[model samples]
Target: MRRAARARIDLNALRHNLSVARAAAPGSRVMAVIKADAYGHGMREAARALAGLSDAFAVSCVQEAAVLREAGITQPLVVLQGFKDDAELVEVVRLDAQTVLHEPGQLACLESSHLETPPAVWLKLDTGMHRLGFAPVEAAALVQRLRTGDLVAGHPGLMTHLACADEPARPESETQLRAFDEAVAGLPGEQSIANSAAVLRMPAAHRDWVRPGIMLYGASPLIGVSAESMGLRPVMTVGAPVVAVKPLRPGDAVGYGGTYVCERPRTLAIVAIGYGDGYPRHAPSGTPVLVRGHRCPLMGRVSMDMLGVDVTDVPDVRVGDMATLWGEGLPVDEIAEVAGTISYELLCSVGGRLQAEYVES
Candidate 1:
């Protein structure tokens, strides 16, 4: 634990975020999205922490779902991308996992295979994303096919991904919701249309199920909105200890490329975290890094194993002192904004090199 980068995961914060999701959609079942290694919080750890609170766990594929099952998680696992092939279909069936049939080929595969045990299914509609799922116009026919052909154990639940639910100003969320509603009119199955943004902002989109993803990790799903304003507590606090302190004279340079030239004498601290530990390489000068809870400006190019921070404003900076990269005093959103990316990318980009410390407080 000496002078190294560490990602401290607060389990209690995760529980609090789940409560926020629950309080927002009181009547809907919560399908906590834990894909991409639970957004780099460690999938097995996330599953263990959210097991009882989450109604079900949603992963990107059979492989991630398999990891959860191997970790002894008993909650219903939803394979969002569904199976990749016949072998995957068999594995999905074996895992007793719920699969989403989004394309005609997947539907055809299920119908023709005639496996001994059929998987519980959800029919995904494209609505407006135009990425995956069947067309909205074809929802009824597909649901009927799943029912009449005995391709699933029961009525297939209906789900659609929101193309622009995070952008509250956009008309796409409402349009997609309307399309989804029209597509499944009078269908007997449960419906899910609300992702994290929809869950908090558009209660109308909260149907029989609500899928909470980034918000579950205490990151804001909407643009320009702060997670702190939404009562979400950061679950992961990444900190790196100061390894060196250099006195900078006027015109002195720091980091790779010498992008930062000192205008005035300053105290610079080198922290033991950089792009190699998943810190954004492109995060420019002036990005906030918390030193003793005070904001410090990042100087020059981020290196592979270290970053330079201007800690002159803070008194008595020294080696072994920790600088918070994000979380706790800082929100991941702020870093993502300066890094020219989204919170999902920043969180998912966290590397395995850092020491992981789990905390409940």
Candidate 2:
């Protein structure tokens, strides 16, 4: 079935972005974060595309990792949230997956498990995120317990999440780095702290493994640094076709609520996309949409299955013309800004109804 709205997934662009991450942190291994279904790009597809390139894969939970395993992915999978209970721990062991020991209860659960072979573990230090991990002061003692308990396979690697690596001017990242370094001062294991933002900006945080999430999908993690400027290419392009075109007289209202009134005689193109297809309904007028290779301004409110675009200046725009929501010539970030959101939300929010096409080259 041909869907009116579609998203094109570019695997070549995905590889290019992975290369960019490798170049940014030459000494660190890349753990591609594929959580949230690879940021809604489709988990198994993304894992397959990145299988050979990524040193390892990181997901939010065991179920997501199981998807990759079922897809025949052999790369090591890291469960960021760790196991919720001993049953999940058994599954982690069965899948040969690694896990992060972020909280005291997780360690307690592991201590009680009697698996013949335990999965490798990463000890998360709280640093300052406060969302996960043990306090820096308590991390060393926990690490000691894990090492002596024989509950974890191999020495547990040290990991921390940075609270403000995207904000270069802030000292929070540096402070966290200092705390992480001190906590794991004499401990023996790999250290990791850099996420996508830190992988590109903070070299010091790229210790052992660099977890690149949004950057792997070619979206900028920092507010000021664009993906293109960082040598990254977008992997997804969202588009829809124009369903109707009409002439509007001055003083005529368009769409529901009559919020937008044509100031003068103009040509309007009705695009077959809207909030129902994951286009942000909150996107205000003047959002840019490309029609027939020409930039057109979106007018009025976005409806459930359509949107209004001012095609008065676009030459010969007609029904069946393709309108690019974002990708290629249009950056998703720009649309996200006009929508009062971020590109991550825009990409992840793409509805299931929209068809997806994967391009290898």
Candidate 3:
């Protein structure tokens, strides 16, 4: 049996999320973002779970692509960050993975490399994000350069990430879309601009391939509608067992900072999970934690190895009672809100200290 803290992963939910992505962007191919260990849902398990469902898998580095290849995932894995050095190009090509070329430096490296054949590349255009990608004119020129000469092989596509697609009302999305459309208008093989947010909100941005990250794990990228409501199920459940229980008197300070002082006599259950275990230590007081299937409010500052939960309403909760930090009845977004972050951070930041159980479909 696993210890007090365990992370239960549901493979069925992963597949469901991919289907949701497909349904959202009916015309575009889906690229499942499995970077950061599938956003902390376990890369191999997530890849296995999403096998065949996702058109291609996307990761940040060549090493991640290699990991997927070693795990027998033969899908066309796209390296979003492209290669860091020329040496990584061989391994990337050997693994049959695609790379994203966003900067002049990467293209220069590719130009300088000696390969039997050039790998397929996805050209990222700087529509609006400004973080990574070539400007509109520069992007068009590069495509012409690659096509005119044999500097690169395989199909080259245009891809741009949305900056504010989460909020559909924002005019920036439309502006970016227009810019992207204009930039890749006549000089492209395919266009991919939609992320998880754009796929759900901006239908016009769904060009050739949609790269979805959080939505594949059933986390809501937008505020109003959740992935589950769109027929997606959560894949990760973070739970820990109560290790200690004690009665707290009124006015008793709880945990560090004395942030939460008991206003009434209440029974506190100390769960065996904390910052060290990847539970957000900055989570504010009154954060909801599931205890014995009941909603229990957190009492104080989260420690390095334990957090105090007020289980006063639960009549006879024990030290071995289970607490869900997020997942199942407790949504990751809700927990993220309390932690002053988003579900993406909460899910991906989950440390390797806890035991993980992979449930296959």
Query: Which model scores highest in lDDT?
Result: 1
What is the C-alpha lDDT profile of model 3 across 179-276, one tens digit per residue? 88887877748888888988887889888899999888878988767666777688899989889999999999998888898889999999999888
User: Given candidate 2, what's the lDDT at residue 305?
Assistant: 87
TM-scores, all models, native as reference: 0.98, 0.98, 0.97
lDDT of 2 by residue, 300-358 (tens): 99998899999999888878988999988898888888899998999899857789899
| Model 3: lDDT of residue 330 | 89
Please estimate how well model 1 matches the true structure, expressed as its whole-model Cα lDDT.
Answer: 0.92
Tell me the lDDT of candidate 2: 0.90
In order, what lDDT does every prediction score? 0.92, 0.90, 0.87
Give the C-alpha miss distance for residue 248 in model 3, angstroms: 1.3
Give residue 80's error in model 2 in angstroms: 0.8
Candidate 1: which stretches are off by over 4 Å? 1-3
Q: Give the count of colliding residue pairs in each prediction.
A: 0, 0, 0
Judge candidate 1 at residue 307 and give its lDDT. 94
Clashing pairs in model 3? none
